[model samples]
Target chain A: SQQGEEDPQALSIQEGENATMNCSYKTSINNLQWYRQNSGRGLVHLILIRSNEREKHSGRLRVTLDTSKKSSSLLITASRAADTASYFCASTLNYGGSQGNLIFGKGTKLSVKP
Target chain B: GAGVSQSPSNKVTEKGKDVELRCDPISGHTALYWYRQSLGQGLEFLIYFQGNSAPDKSGLPSDRFSAERTGGSVSTLTIQRTQQEDSAVYLCASSLGPSGVGTQYFGPGTRLTVL
Candidate 1:
């Protein structure tokens, strides 16, 4: 299973606070991506970090990949109430089998209180 | 055009009924995929299609499940004599290429409720 496992299945935080989510995977990957899903909606791509790249940033989203530990972390700084949504980390493998199918984690549901 | 689109957004069926779910991928995308997610569970890989080649159906759980891509643009996933365990959200995704390592755009999934 190339599935990335995300910890802290659920989180609640005050608006404007920083939120951190961690993901762990079993196999080597070509790149790792973070996505956000509004309730009952399609997934929105957040950020992607490649194997050689240790960290990446897009807007307020920061993604850090540690291949040595086979883990990655997503940090949302100055999160707002609109940032409340489920977040998932997915990875593309070095091996090819599931064509364009991203192995997604169970996801972490976040609730930001205004 | 627009992003990936899926039809029959919600489906409710009885046991032993056959169901077909359709997916219309982004225009010009060459890769399409199917996945099933049970309540609170992670996404489960079902099948993958790349251009006109044979699909990689290794993730399909049983022979009862099958899918096909027509014209490399649209796809239909057919489940035969479905069982109660088949209840889940069926998601479809499409990518610009056969690079499974690339980011994909997902469609709003069809939620299956098997009674």
Candidate 2:
């Protein structure tokens, strides 16, 4: 079963606009990671925010995790057509053992119109 | 450095036939994983391997699905008696270790089609 669920199943915006996607999970997680898929093939690692960390930034990407709400959001500033792809949020359960594999969300398809 | 690689970018087979998919993880990486993605669906974990420890096969959907890793470098996922529902993108990934917080590198994935 999918532990996380991305919001706004789909999003569309013009180039240069910032795009934000949200993901909510039902269980306690050790960490939450974001990934991007282009052409529906390979997935690229975007960013990861550990449970103890609240926010992280890399290049033009900003991710915020609200453990209290059991949700996380990905923000892409100055979006470009190249950013057009599917974004997914995956979480690793906080079971008191080996971290194990990740549980992924359905993903949010973002379209950046040039 | 070379990233994870999978064989036969695409495969087409008839139902009831068996098929094998291969994954070669990055050199020196000790963790490997397999996942299945159906059209418009989230990725589902199929199996995981960490070093010499027994692989976690809890995610495998059936007895027909089996996987093995050799010499801690290459892994193969085999499906016995494939079904139409088995048609999906099979993805492979590898990381430095099994830490949940580590980033996993993914391959281009194999598009499996069952007729």
Which segments of model 1 are wrong by more than 4 Å? A96-100
In terms of lDDT, the best-performing candidate is: 2
User: Which pairs, if any, clash in model 2?
Assistant: none
With a 3 Å backbone cut-off (N, CA, C), the pairs that clash in candidate 1 are A100-B100
Error of 1 at B106 (Å): 0.3
Model 2 Cα lDDT, one tens digit per residue, B37-106: 9975569998888874544677898999999999999999999999999999999988886766588889
Which lDDT values do the candidates have, in the order given?
A: 0.86, 0.91
Q: Report each candidate's C-alpha RMSD, comma-separated, in the order given.
A: 1.5, 1.2
lDDT of 1 at A61: 89
Per-residue lDDT of candidate 1, residues B1-115 (tens digit): 6999997899999999999999999999898888887775668778888875545677898999999998989899999999999998898988887867667888988989889
Instruction: Summarize candidate 2's per-residue lDDT along A1-114 as a digit string, tens digits.
Output: 789999989999999999999999999999999999998799999998999999999999999999999999999999999999999999889886644688999999999999
User: How far does residue A78 in candidate 2 sit from its true spot (Å)?
Assistant: 0.4
Fraction of the reference Cα-Cα interface contacts (below 8 Å) that each candidate reproduces = 0.73, 0.88
